[model samples]
Target: MDAILRAAGEVLGTELSEPVDLGGSPRTVVLRCRTASGGSVVVKKYGTEPDDLRAFTAEAAGLSLRLAGPELLGVDDSIPLLVMEDLGSAPTLADVLLGNDPQAALDGLSAWARGLGRLAVASVHRRADLAALSAGYGMGVPSWDEEPWLLRHAAEFPAALAGIGVEAPPELAGELERIAATGANEYLAFTPGDTCPDNNLLTPDGLRLIDFESACYLPVFMTAAYCRMPFATCWCVFTLPAGLAEKIEETYRTEVVEAYPQLVEDEIWQPGIRRAVALWTVYLTTNLIPRMAKDEPAHRTRRPVPTLRQLLRHRWETASTLEEFPAFAETMRLLLRDVAGDWDVPPLPGYPAFGDFG
Candidate 1:
């Protein structure tokens, strides 16, 4: 620790104070250090494991991307230490979801949408840079046909639901294939991989995303659709109220146009967004089934997960909002009918007042 801090200080041209440990994976260490000049910088150190080193190296490459991450102060690629500008102790969107400030939550959501939109627009032509970050890490852009997560999980559809007594329609299988095909061919953009509220900090300047250990380039609609649902990739799985969801989607779409006006004429704006939502819904639901069946959170990536009953309720409610996709609606209706008794318990305690979150 002392040697690394000394190295970081030498790189930053300053004396560093004691570090504050910020919890992260077992293989990574995050810290905040105050400089002799009173400014603070963040440092992330990787463990000696091979996977950790790969993730650390990839994150360093990701943080170097100008628009997607914080200002990089210094980096020692060998030890895989990164010194970056401090984003401060701003409350994450997750904090807002658990707090009483509805308006602040909305502002944070809008800021997050706009920030991601700006990043996607800026990186549209920077595939070389993203590819460099992904080299040897196997985390780069995934084609529709090559997306392991979608392919792995979507195959479990209809069949997996049957164990819980919900039979998915044959039409749904064809729809999933169609959605995946379209997703592979259109609206490619850079993605931070983890779009959780905690990863996106509402900094004073704007919203900034952190933790790029899994950054990649993917279709822009995939992200749009991911956020539209209950943040499926993240641990914070609660339904974003209807009005709030619409507003955030509008804000994101508006920024996409504002960032890349040419997209409007290319006819790749709204329709692509709709397609992404439908496709991602099918993709997310497929992943959600195993967790729902086992009565566990989809991913144990974070703490304070909703209970099994709450998880199902949130999934059903979020799926209910997908009326535009009749296939998803039918799938959800079947699951809800079959699993009604199992999820009969009330929601998890203190499940925030989303009714007023709009």
Candidate 2:
């Protein structure tokens, strides 16, 4: 740590203080530094491949133009480092989301939408640059609609339903296939591929978007899809109030449509919402199943051992909670019906089909 800080100081002409962990997947080290004149700065060192450095540089360049995010301090070789404004007063979007104030969450979502709208607008004219960034971030073109994840979920529907104690209806698979096959060749746009609340910070200035590592050019609808996942899960799981979900979706939809009128059609919004719900459901099911399977004994010991039939009934009863949002409910209904139908699916617009299912 000392050696890295020394090297950083030599490169930036600053004396570094102790390092702090920012707690991300790859674990970034954020160092607080001071120059000889006592000016404070923050430096971030990322754990990523050299190729990913290109994406970081591109994001820094994009943020530099908009002046909406932190400032780029410098880079040492291919290791892109950021010198950002210290945001000690602000809380992360995650912190705000975990708070009791629903209005704050709504405000935060609105701010996020506005920031994203600005980003989209800013990138619209930078076609070549945006494309390069997308490539650097690994968002290559191909259809992701009929990806194996879709198939795995569709094929595993029976097991999932059985595990949850619901009857796996056969017709729903076909409907999902049709829904997946329906949209192709849609106009693409720049999407912040990672829209997790943790990626947004609520500052005095407004909601500041951070972590552009996954930002890429993709179908505009997919952006909506990406953003809707956490929102739907939070609402469905009862972590967020029912009405707040509608507010969040409306704010996002309004901001995007206001910026790009081409996205105003119901076909666009409806499909995007459905895709979000479907993808989120698959994500949750995949993540939770193993845990549930392993923890079932402990879970059952803590509670009553309902029959598998009763258990399945409980799962769907809980699933219906997600249906509180009219759009989400409709999508769930359609997806379930599709699974029942054994439908042949097509690819999603603008994303590659990565075959890994874990």
Candidate 3:
């Protein structure tokens, strides 16, 4: 912490005070500092790695050009720190959503959507800058769809099924097999890979997107898709006050379609949303199982063994067969077949193209 303060003070040309801990994920330690010129700043310290430094720099540059986040005061390479305007007053979108107030949640979601739209439009012409930041960063687009991490969810199916005290219908496995057979890629626009409500800061003035550690250029659907699962979970769990869920969903759907007219059709939106949900389910399930095993062993008996089983069951019950989520299911199926070898599965549709956006 002292090292961070000293480094930040040098970079900001100021005398920094002792660091204050703002405990959260990734173990962030913050400091309140004053420049020699009497300007106040906040510094955040994370691990020292080239990728981490690059993300900080890219976020600083991206936010500096827009009104979407805190100002980038400066960056210190020595301590791998970021100095910026102190936004202690800002509340994360997660906080607002958890309030369970319909109006507040809708407002926060609207703000988040608009902020994402701004980022996407602004990035269209900044390809060069984005390219440079992504170069050799080991954080570019995934070459294949079936990421190994996703298999962790597949492994959890047995546990989740047992926990739920139900056997997955044979149809569920069939759908999984079908999803593994179709491989396709469609480019939309860039988005932060982890654009959850928790990553957005809601200030009195407006919403400020935070945490660019997972930022990358990808299909615009990636944002809406990645974001939908949390929104769905939140809606499902809270039941919204009155008919607010319908209104919020309408608002989100309309805004997303208006912002990217190319995906107004179900053919595009359906697949995108499904892929987003399935992938996110796998992500959440995988993380949940390990955490459950360690911190909540008592609950483990009720927890899903194979994370994907719960997700698959949920998908089958809530959504139509994989036939309904064509593109997304196909992508998953293809990825699985590639990784796990061929399995007996019914024929599936060919990948559909929404034309080239690039």
In order, the Cα lDDT scores of the candidates are 0.68, 0.50, 0.50
Mind giving the per-residue lDDT tens digits that candidate 3 earns over 163-215? 63434444544444333222224444555545666667888877776665445
Listed in order, each prediction's TM-score against the native is 0.75, 0.63, 0.65
What's the residue-level lDDT of 53 in candidate 2? 55
The positional error of residue 129 in candidate 1, measured at the CA in angstroms, is: 2.1
Best by TM-score: 1
Model 3: runs farther than 4 Å from truth? 34-39, 48-67, 136-187, 231-246, 256-259, 294-358
Where model 2 places Cα greater than 4 Å from the true spot, the runs are 48-68, 133-187, 226-229, 232-238, 283-358
Model 1, runs deviating above 4 Å: 1-17, 35-38, 47-54, 76-81, 136-148, 156-175, 237-242, 258-305, 320-331, 347-358
Q: Compute the lDDT for candidate 1.
A: 0.68
Clashes of each: 0, 22, 18
Prediction 3 TM-score vs. true: 0.65
RMSD of each: 4.7, 10.5, 10.7
On TM-score, the stronger of 1 and 3 is: 1
- Decreasing TM-score order of the candidates: 1, 3, 2
